[model samples]
Structures are given as structure tokens and as C-alpha cells.
Target: MNLLPAYVLLDLETTGATPARDRITEIALIRYENGEEVARWQTLVNPHMPIPPFIQTLTGIGDDMVQAAPDFESVAPRLYQYLDGAVLVAHNVRFDHGFLKHEFQRIGIILRQKVLCSVKLSRLLYPQHRSHGLDAVIQRHQIVVAARHRAMGDVEAVAAFIEAAGRELGEDRVALEVARLMTAPSLPPGLDPSLLDELPETAGVYLFFGADDAPLYIGKGVNLRSRVLAHFSGKTTDMAQAVRRVEWLETVGEFSALLLESHLIKTRQPLHNSLQRRQRQLCAWRLAAAPDIHPQAQLVREDAIDPTALGDLFGLYRSRKHAEEALRGIARNHALNPRLLGLESGDVRASSEPDAQHYLRLKLALAAQRLKDWPYPGKIAVREYDATSQRTQLHVFEHWCYLASVDNEADLHDVLAQRSTPVFDLDIYKLLQQVLLPPAKTGAKPAIGGLEIVHFQDGYDQQKTSSSSQ
Candidate 1:
């Protein structure tokens, strides 16, 4: 009764965090059979790319060190042999597993192995401990290590922790924990496990497709792989079973993910995403600007609404009926006459109050739902960057409407050149309000901070915009 029949304690150092885009720079693993050490292997992989300066400082694996080493394709076969039929053991196993899977796929070899994460094991055995990262584990167990961030050093450290756990918790207790972790949740028969392996654990939106390429669901997540896998964990739903293909678009941050998810759900109209489906009859209350008007509220359809007059717009409703019902409720709550508000057909004099007082009450009741005007004088871009992947997305906006999201500054001119009349979207409006508007209370910070707002006044000037952004 060993922890596992056979397992390979492994670790990897990569050029970056994203597996699909980044390459592996180094790998190390020690294989065990029947609780006895069997084989040990390590290699420096030439990623064929420049390693970031920070990564070089962190892992001490610079371009010069790996320039002379064998590339991943050259080492794939032997690495596969070492990992064959072995439970992959590593600290934060998904990171290592994702990189390995992507690298192997590049060489036309599929690498699949049962993974056991040492971090999870640490948590299970030591529930009282709040930290389970490698640094934390090393400090707790007093494990000796020749190196810290290097691949072989980390692999050795993790193996030492596992051995120490077995001794302290007893072999049987450790074995039980290992067994519990080894039993991975099964995936649907229609879906390929490799697809899940290829998913990057980053902010992104994912789409599930059923037969004939019909979209079953569209969703966004801060960690795409973990969120997608959670769907198939305990019990597979009918929608999950119908999912035959999976696709994803990675974003720099959750903000972009939310925007993209909202856009896709409305446009694609996925069968299971009924809540976010497009509202064909979307309407909002447009308060009358004229002073002498009796019933001051009017319902305007989405196509007829003016983006420039957002300040006058009140609550967004799915249909004309919903807008009427909401306004009726507002009138009732404010003690205003529904007949004067145009909810009912009657003589204006029949109302108990004067026209001015009734209009004031109507405006006061709808003040909370009033849409905020665009704060900027012109079009602005909210830039989001992922430091790990070096990915950047610039979301351009004007009058609370999303113009376009571009990856580079070079495309900004084209977006401006092709810019058409900004059609206001209720979802995009709400999102921008949440992210960009100032806090309601005086002297309070906004909901989201550290946003890089670049202004495009007269036109898109690359140099000026670049300097201004900096």
C-alpha cells in the first residue's frame, strides 16, 4: 500500500505563464516504482524565444544558458518514455501539466498522465496551515534544497515534502489522501480530455458547442480551465453532455472577459444562456426635457434611443411592457398620478396635484436609475494588460458604447476611421458605468482602480497617445 503504484515527481520552468503561447525552458522529474526511486531525468529546453528579464532573474535560466541546449521537439520522445504510465507529481501540477501538454502537442505527440498536485496534498494533510506554496512548505518542513526556482531543485523539494508527510502522518493516512486525490472526475464521452488540458488557466470566455456547431452555452471566467472542469466534476448536466466541442478566447483581465462574454451571449444567443439573450424590444424611459409637458416620461426603443442623450435615459427594460410596468411602479411608490404619467388615459385635471409638482415627483422617483453621462470629452481607451503573458487589450469607447477592442496601437486609427454611429447597448452601458464612473459618495474612490485611460481627442495620434498613456 504505497501512495500510488507509480508516480513521477516533476517540475518545469517556462518562459512565461501561458502554456499555449509560452515555451518550456527547463524540465525535471524523478520516477518512483512501488515507493522506491527508479529513474531521475532533467533537461534544459531551448524555447526558441527570448526569456523575459524577470524570468531570467527568477529561474537563472537565461537565453545564453539554453541557446546550446536541445529544443523541446528533440527531447519529447525520451521525456514521454520517462513519464509513461506514471502519475505526474508536482507543485501546482496544472501549470506543469499544461506546459507539457502544449509542448508535446507541438511535436505531434499527445502527453496524457494522471496528475497529483503536491500543493493539494499539503492542504489535505495539514488543514490548519494557511499556506501550501513551495516556499511555505519548505519553511514548514525544513526541507533542504540545492536550488529554489530551477526545475530540478523544485522537484527535489516537492519529493522531500511528500516523504516527510508520509513519516509524520503515517503511511496509511498519507496513502488515503493520495488515493482520494488520484481519483479524478470523469469527463463527458463526447469531449476530448486533451481539449481541457489545452485550456489556459487565465481570464477568458469559453463557448460550448453541441451538434451541427450550435452553441450550447457561453460563459466567462477568471480561470477558464478550472471553471470549465467544474462543470463536469460531480454530475454531468444534460447541457454538459450535449457539449461536443469547446472554444475559448483569452483576455488580459476579467474586465475584457466580462465584456466579451456579454457580447457573445447577446450575438450568438446560445441555447442554454437564455438569461443574456438579445432583447429585440429593448426600451428605456426617456424623460421629457420640455418644461410645460404634463406626463414627463416616455418609453424609447433601443434603435430610436440617442446615445448623446444618456443623461435623460432612466432604467433599461427588456420590452415596452416592462418599461411601462416599471414606470407605473415608480409613480405608485412616489405617490404620483399614473394618469398624469401616461400610464392611464384620463383628463389631466383629474389628478390631485399640479403639473409642476407631479413632474418633479416623477423625476425624483426615477433619479436613482438615471444613466450617467460619459465622463470623458471624447473617445477613450481602457487598456488592460496581463504581465505574465504580455498580452494587452485596448477597449475603445465613446458615450458609454463599446467601439472596438484592439490588441495594438497601430489598429486604433483604423477603428476610428471605420467608426460608425455608436449604437448604445444596455449591457455595455452598465459595464462601463461600473468600471469608469466615480463613486457616488464625495471623495470616494471608483469601483475599479488602476485603469489606464487614454484619451483620443481630435484623432488617434500614436505618439501623443503613447506619451499620454505613460
Candidate 2:
């Protein structure tokens, strides 16, 4: 007889795949120690979200069945306690683990444990077998699974498979294979052991810190945990060694993650985030007062931009020097006068008269890149919704400048009542490319993370006039 290490056979029934957009309907786990069953637990989790019709039919966990069940918050504490210091075993552990982590992430809890996927275990132990899913395992071993898709039934099936494997091919061989599958990630000694469990696989911004809590690096990823883990997998640089701790903030999608990362890097000026030096003063050149004889380019500071009300704007640059360099390059390429572009303050004399003709064409070519003024006459809102988390955020914008993000219509009123000038961000301008631009400009259909455009045009003229006069 071989003594098996403490482990929990686990299974979950979720509303759907893609953990970011789905909810766990149920959880079942059977704990075993020294090759004997020690404890067993199961629960119907109130996802606080709707269970799709297909999921209900497939899993037989209808909305009505889970209506009065305790939400994950109510059960998280006990569930966390139950899995402590035990390896998590499941048919396809990633699927189960993903749902568990995502659910815990919503309520700001970290669920981390060594995971052993029995599906993988089956393949490893029985190399001759091509099919390793629970159904295949059950069919091959002739084990009874009373309930097919239900969590407890599936968990029991997994436990049975392990037992059969131990008897058929020596417990020692099974235990060694289980140990290999249960390997945990090796993390930095300075970081907490539990931190890896909390780092969500969802889109988010991650920050790394060094000694004295200095911002070492700021990064964004769709799968935050994998990206953060890859950085520490090998001792490649000082970055791996200098890091003390890691922190992350979750976003609904990649668009939000990238925007948040850029904003933090610019604002925090992390020592390791080495791209932009003059990111703090984002600026651009705008073709002011369309078609005047003196078609001069005006410097539009981000602090004063109303993107929705803007005219032809060009090349969002972080510094005055880069903006000037770009304008000069454009002038040189198009044979336009640099003086008219505000790169120089010299007069347009008789000899330089020919360059003015070139300036007119330059304005037209540059118009294509111009920021679209708020097409609607007034303020409008762009919405971003997370299908899985069921979280919605409405970003209010005026003249292309983002004003505020509100959760509900009632909150929209509060955001509008406060008179605030919309500031432009180069980072946001680029981030908006993911959603705001149509196929022609971005060269693809923009997926705005469920962005719904809403117009708030009533009494718009008055506000525009008031802000402009000021």
C-alpha cells in the first residue's frame, strides 16, 4: 500500500466557457488524505448573474434552483479554508480553476493551490489512450458516474479514476505522476506565496516594485497571471532580481487594460517603464480656423482639448520637439512652408509665396487624420460592458475628450452637473482607436468591448456656448 498525499477531487458547473464572461453554477470537492476520504463539500453558488438557457439544460442547474443559494461571497471563506494546503484535482483542472479564480477575483479573494488535471493524468499514465476526458476515462475503466454533468457526480468520477489507476498500475507510479502534475509555480522569495493565486488571468495592469517600494515596471496583459509569471520564470535580467512585490488592477478587456497601463506608466513614471520621457505633457498640432489666408497651425495642449469640438488635429506627440520635428518632416515631404506650420515665425515673403500653395494641399492631406469632432451636437456617452462580470461603464465625452465614467443613468446627471473642462490624453487617443475608429481608418471593425454610443444632445448649445466663452 502507498500513502497518497492530501488532495481534493474538484469539479465545477459554470454558465459557459471563457471565465471572464461566465459564472460558476456549482462547486464539488472530495478531500482525501493518506489514501482515505477525509471530507467532502458541495454548494450551489448564486452567480448573481443570469444562467443561460443552454447552460441550464446542459447542467440541469436552472436559475430557479440557484435563486436562494448563497453567493460566492458567503461561501468563499469556507471554500478557501477547505482547499488550504491541498492539491486540486479535476477532470480538466484549468477549466475548473479558471472559473474558481474568476469568481473569487470579483469579490477580491485569491484562490491558489497546486492543481492536478486528471485528464492529463490519464494521458500520462495510459499513453496508449488518445481520449482522456472524464467520459473516456469512465468508459475505459467501466466506472459508474450517476450524474453526468453535475459537479458532485463528476468529482466522484474523478476520484474513482484515481483509485482505479492506483490499483491497475501500482500506487507508487500513480503518486509520482500526480506529484508531477501538482507542481506549483516557483515565485520570488520577496513576494507572498499566495499572490500568484490572486493575479487574475483577465485583462489588467500589473505593477512591479523593488526595494523601498519604488515602481520598477508597469505592464498590461490579457492574461495577467501568465504574463507576470513569465517574467519570473528565469533569471534573465536585473528585473527578475530587483522585484520585491507585484500588484495588479483588473479591467474588463484588453482595451481597458492597455489604457490603464499607459496612464499609470505616464503618471507614475516607473523606473523600468522606459518608453516615453515627456509623456506628462501630451500635445498635438491642430489646423486652426479652417481656410483662413493665414492658415497657421495652433498648438493644442491636452489640458485644453475638447476632442468632440475639434477641427483637423494631427500627430499626437508627447513633446514640443517631437511635434516640431514631425511638422517639419511633413512640410519637407509635401513641399509646404515650415513658417505656415508654426515651426518658424518668419514672414511669408514674395519668394516664399509658392510654399503657401503647398500649405493648402498639406491641410487637406492632414484632414484625413483629423480627430472627428463630436458628430452629435452635444455630449454623448460611450459604454463598455463586460459580458462575463456583467459590469457596464459609460464614458461621457465632449468634443472627443472623455469627461467621466458613470455606472448608471442616475450617475450621469451628477457627472454632467459639475462643470469641468475635458482634457486630452495622447494615450486615450490611441486607446480610442480600439473602438472609436471605423474600419477604413483602423483597417478593421473596431470592437469597443461592448461600447454603445449614446447621445445627450438636449440643451447642448447653451453648455457649449458657456464653456467656449470662458
Candidate 3:
């Protein structure tokens, strides 16, 4: 009921919109007790996903920036302590609170705390104004934010907004409004409610668990903080429920996070994640044999294809339904034969009508948009570094699929030489296809065959001369 009793001002940077699909990148919380700044905390979390180019540009938190930050598990306790027994306050409190609640829920903890949204308060008090967002509030109050979009600056802005509104609108009005917004939502009994400061802004995946360490959900994002918060803050009902514990995995790049998130969701099969796509259902439209020998219908996957080669292939789909739907649409629009195209269950017929020719033209146009050839040949690798662990890893792939991920060059070579052909994953294949297209240009560089495949056992790989056998 007492709105100002030990308030923790919080801000979070996250990956994307869907909490179950994104992760936290950074956290900043400033705790105030009796109207004084008592403590400050911050962290960069590996969200385990590629920061969308736009988000990275806006937040200035890129894949390279959080390369060394710790994962959420390592930083959670300190954050919990800071936010313990405090009212939560933020510009858009929904975003901050939702992320915290969801993240904590994943780690087997439930969090319920009084939340005060400055946006609501600002709107209520300034009824004439149309905007109540952070930027709007900062402009209205003439508050100078040392940094914009970053977690700490935003949290500080909220604190400033609260202080300014209290002065201009009177303490009673501000207090009452804060009290109204401070209603702590119901949470599962097992979680902890607290403010977190300075979580890293990195790409990675996060997980939530319920009672007895049961996984509830798994997600990936560019910014772990923002994505995790969206879950609890008036977004999706399913994300808010079924989470009791918070857990996360930090990844070096978006590719790693994407792969990891898919694998974890399948293996853990968290309750909250049940509605998510199943691995078996994941599919892609590989350009196989068209029913017509000359004029082919766009081939859809009759069965699953190896995902690693997905980059080599094209038209990746998460399920048969998706692939078929797309193909059917193409068939109808192009006037291609349904039976021939495999959209319908019947004999193949090559349409000879002028309408059919137009349809084929249209179908080719559509396929061109969706088709993506494999980017890399044989094996290629991307490197990831852990700031906290002070380690770097090389994620290796071949035929548009991952064979193995290794820490050292020796391991990379061993994986390359000894690793068996990876089973096909529609998701991974799609991912590789997306990443590998438009092969890297080698202007004056040596030809592919002349390029040496270096395998350094104790350290990094060495680009040695190619053997005469090649």
C-alpha cells in the first residue's frame, strides 16, 4: 500500500517481442530506500541470439559488445538481492516487470512485487498530452539522459520522471497514482520478486522451469532483457503461466542461439513450450523432382531432408502444413497442375494451356523469392567468445548443417575430419541457407582449392598450403 517504501527503479534490454522466443541482453536497477540511492547494479547477459540489425543499431549493443558478459544464472542472485522487498518502478513498467517475472519463473522462482508504471502515471496526470512514453516524458520535463535506449539511462529517466512529477503535480497526486499502478500481480508461490541491474546485452537463449526443475519454456533473442520481460508484461498469457524457475544459455552469435533454442525446446519439451513447433514437424521445400519432366511444379518435401544442407537447399518451412500451404498457393496462382505439383493427391499432368504457362511463370517468380542456395561449401566455422569464462569457441558446419562445435583449432579439425554427417534439421538448414547466401567475395584472394585447410591442435587453426593431391 505504501508506494514509496523501498522502491527499485528497473530497466531491461532484451532480444525481441515474444518472451518464449527471445532473451534478455542487459539489466540495470537502482534501489532507493527512504528516498535515497542505496545501491546500484548492472550486468550484460548473453541473450544467445543475433541482435536484429535494427535493434543493434538503435541500442548500440551488438554481438561484439556482449561477447564476454556472464549468463543470467551467474548474475541472478545479486540481482535478486537488490530488488528484494522493493516496489518496482519503470517508464513502461510492464516491459520491465514482465521480463523479471518470466526470467525468475524459469529458474524455479516465482516473483510478485508492487509495480508502478510511469507511463500510466504520466498519462493520468497529464491528461491533455497524447504521449506518455519515456522519450516523451523526458522531452516534457526537460530531463537530460546521458544515454538513450540503454538500460541504466532509461531507469534513471524513470527515476527523474517520478521526481519531477512529484514536484509539479503535488506529492499526494503522484503518491496516489503510484499506489494505483503498484498493484503486484499474482505469481506462483515459489518465485522471488526483485530488481536486477546491469544485465548484459548479448545474444543468447533463456529457459524457464517450474516445480522440481521441470522446464517450462525456452527462448532466444538478441537482447535477452527485453524479450524476457515481454512475457510478464501484459503480452501473452501462456508465457506468464507455467514458469517457476529462470535459467538461460549465453551464445556467441545469433546462429548459435537459434540452433541452441531449437534443440533445447525439443529436448526439454517445457510445458510452456509445448505449443511451440516440434522438431519432427519442422520442414523445408527442397527443389526435388517436379511431376512434369520439362515444366516442373515447385517440389515440396515428401519427407524430412537433412537440415545441415538446408543452406544448400531452399524454401525451409517449420512444418509440412506451412510448406504445403505455400506450394498450394503457388500452384493455384500459377495454374500449375495440383496433382503434378503434389499439392493434390492424384496423377501428375503437365498443363498445356496458355493459362498454365502463365501459372508456371508466376510459380517460378515465387520460387525465386523463396529459393536460397547453400552459402558455404564443405565446412565453415564462426567463433564465439565468453567474457566471464574467458574462452572462445568455434562452431563448425558443413553441407549447410552443423557437424560439431569445438573450442580449439584441433577440435575444429577433429570435428571436421571425424564428425559424422549431421542429421537433417529443417530449422538449421533454413538458418544456414539464410546465412550462407551470396558467398563471401574473394577478389584477389587465392582460389577455393588453393586455399589451405588449417587444423591447429593446441591453438588456433593455421591456413597452410593445399596438398598436391587436391
Candidate 4:
């Protein structure tokens, strides 16, 4: 066997520096086998979390742009396999490599592989030069810089430097150096010695497949290659029993990765993802009467909660039973009569009844905590992100009830144009009530402003049936 290992050039664009908290935005990888081109992959993944303004400006990747990209969990397997038997190449190798290892470790994967830092190679080969950064290398070697800090451009720069090194140093010398660079890093015995230094640090998801190709866990990171390796830093005692194969996905942005993850957990229902896939039931406390009218408590589903008009609504609940319990607690706290509050069905006491004073006292006391009236004139939606799946999900609300979620602009338009009345969901009601409610001291404001109300056809109802797979 030649034992001349294949090489992979990798690069990543992330939401921030910290792998544990921040997310990957973009990635690029180029595979070389025995000094010949083998394959290339790249993508933009939505981080599902907001990218700080400074990062947005630096990477030129932002929320509005990656709103539709697939999430990290969806793409982990393929990328992992690509790096399984290669030597990883990068400019500032440690930063890129360190980030990858951290992300993979979070999802419970251990990676071990030989890694080559071009910055180190540049320094080793050209001791006369002072700087070994990507910019310095590109400038010194006259390599064209396209896309700059973006994943693909950075990866291309590494490839360019490799070619330059090969040409200047002679094939024999370059081959020997690359061989020396291919020495595997120290890692846990069970982990593939071929893995750590090989993964591409790009926007996507990664999967840790245990013995017999069973998927042990899934994860997402901007730099897939580095994140994979960090798993073997000798800290993961939990993954000892089951890790074997490595897999990954190169995505376009973090939003796509998040949405994909949520969908995959539901679709694959992977053994390790069971806890994450369980959907929490959502409920809201709705006043039996409409806003602008006297408030009375009623339990409604979250999908029934209206976004634009949440007045007369209070408390989000995990279940209708929970909502009722909360209402009862509030009533007891304020001395409100359970009967007068409609906790039970019965006739109101006559004004002249001897016990009427007690009811009046109770009602007056409860009135202080009674739900408020809707502040807006119409309906709207609150937006949330699924970072792992990389999608922007719109939770619609109308008159203190959550109607449904829209995945795309077309779906948004369809939901807005639909004329059919949305079904009431108690869970959605609670969700809206809690989200829209102002703080005790500061009060709540519109999550987003000036939502247009128009006649709708409910196209989203049908679109939701299939677009969810994407």
C-alpha cells in the first residue's frame, strides 16, 4: 500500500466563536486522494438563533437570508463519511479544528484523525516569511481571493497554497512533508484514528454512528471537521460503549439545519433524539367573553391563540388541566368565588341574597388580576427559529388564539388570505397569552409591527401537508 493518505481542505463560517452556544452558518470542503481531486461539497445553514449584528456583517450571512436553509442535524452523515479516511488541511488549523471538535463532542461523538495546518506548513517551508495567515499566504503566493472569509473561498485558498507548495518544493519533498503531516493525533482507542483531522469545518450537521452503522447521536457546527475531532479530547466518558462511524451534512445556513433537525427527529425518531422530538402540548387562558368585554377565564389550545389580540388572555399552559389549575390558584389567591368566575355551571346568586356580599368581595378581589383586553385591532404571527433544523416557523395568532404555523412567504400569504375560520386550540391560546403579556412593570409591546390583514384562501393548509419534508 502506498500509505500516502488522502487530504481534505476545509473551511467554515460560523455565527460566533463559541461552538457550544453559537452556530454554523456556512461550510466548504475539497477532498484530494493521492494528490488528485476526489470531491467537493459546500452549503449555507441557518443557525436558528439570531446572529449578532457584527457577525452578520462579517460573514455576510444573516437571518432573513438563511431563513429557508436546512438545519445541521439533517446533513451530518454524509460529511462525516467524507472525512472518515482523510487528512484535514486548513489555514489557521487549530481554531478551525478546535471549533469542530467542540461541536461534535456536544452531540456525543468522538473523532480522531491526522490534521495538517497550512499555516504551519507555510511557516515550516518558508521560515524567512514573518506571517503565516491565510491573507499573508494568499498575498505571498498571488492566489486570487474570492469570497474571502466565507467557507468556500477559504477552502480554495488552502488548495491553492498546497499547489504552490508542491510546485516550489518538488513533488518528493512535498509528498514526504504531507506524509509527516498525516501522522494521526492521540485519541481514545475506539475512535477512528482516521477521523479527527479530516472533517471539514463547514456549515452543516454531523452524526456519530456506533458499531454496525447505528447512529449514536447527531450534531451541527460551522466547522464539521474540527468539531468531529474535539470529541476525542479524552473527556467523553459517556460515549465509550457505542461510537464507530462518523457522518455529516454540509448545509447552506443554520436555519436550514435547525428546521431539518426538528423534522428529522420527528421523521427518523432516532433512538438518541427521542427526548428532543417529544412535542410539548401548548395551551392558553382565554376569557370566555371577547376582548373589550368583561374578562372571564377559559382554557384554549395554543393554535387557537390570536397573535394580534391577546388582551383578555393570561398564562400559557402545558395542558388545559394546567390552565384550569392556574386559574383556580389565581382565584384562591384573590378570594374570587369559583362559582361567580364560572369554574362551575350554576345560576348567579340574587343581588339580595345574604351571601351576595361574599361574591362581590370575591369578584372585586379577582378583578385586579383579570385578563386585559386585546391591544391590537387585528391578527398577526410571532416568529421562532429551529436552529438544528434551520427554519423560520411563524406561529399565527388571531384574537388571542394561535391559528397555525407558516413555513414560507407563500405559506404566510396563504394563511393571511384564507377566509376559513381557524379552529380553536387551547394550547395555542396559552402560548400567545404568555408571550404577548407585558412584564408586570414594563408591559408588553408588539413582537413585530404593522401586520396587514387581508382576505385569505388558506393555501397554507394544503402546503403544510408536504413542504414540511423539505
Q: State which candidate has the highest lDDT.
A: 1
Candidate 2: residue pairs that collide: 21-388, 307-399, 307-400, 308-374, 308-399, 308-400, 309-399
- A best-first ranking of the candidates according to their TM-score comes to 1, 2, 3, 4
lDDT digits (tens) for residues 1-470 of candidate 1 = 26788999999999998888899999999999998889999999999999999899999999999999999999988999988888988998888998898898887877767788889899999999999999999999999999999999999999889889988989898899998987666788888877654677778999999978999999999889788888888988999988889999988878899899999998899999997888879988876776357567878899988888888889889988988988888877888787777888888787667778777777889999897777666787877777656777888888888989999888888887775899888888878776664323323333444345567756565312321111
TM-score of 2: 0.68
Evaluation by lDDT, superior candidate among 1 and 4: 1
Per-residue alpha-carbon lDDT of candidate 2 for residues 1-470, written as tens digits (9 for 90 to 100): 23346788888998887788888889898888877788999999988789999888889999999999998889889889778888777887777888888788888976667776788789999999889978899999999988989999999898788889988998889888877655656777788877755566567889999988999999989779778888877564678678888899987667567666877887888897777423656677776565444546777776766565555567677778887788787778777776666677777563345554555787775775576554555566666567655666666766556677767676887776767866766656656655564323423334644455556655421111100000
Best of the candidates, TM-score: 1
Score each candidate by Cα lDDT.
Answer: 0.83, 0.73, 0.65, 0.62
Deviating ranges (above 4 Å) for candidate 4: 1-113, 118-133, 136-194, 208-216, 226-232, 237-240, 244-246, 290-295, 302-313, 320-470
- Cα distance off (Å), candidate 2, residue 35: 9.0
lDDT of 4 by residue, 188-258 (tens): 56676555545655556777776777666776675666566667645654663467677777554443344
For residue 211, give model 4's deviation from the true position in Å: 5.4
Cα-lDDT of candidate 4 = 0.62
TM-score of each: 0.89, 0.68, 0.50, 0.40
Cα deviation in Å at residue 200, candidate 4? 2.5
Instruction: Encode model 3's per-residue lDDT on 1-470: one tens digit a residue.
Output: 22486988888888764455567899999998877788998888887678888778878899887778887767888988887888778876766766777788788877766666677788888999998878889999999998898999888888888778878988788888776655544454555554232223456898877667877778998667557766766544755665666666766555567878988877788776665556466555544443234334344452546444443344656667777787777667765566555566754444455544544564464656454444443566655444422445666666655677776766655676665755665556556544443334322232211122222333333433222112
Full candidate order by lDDT, most accurate first: 1, 2, 3, 4
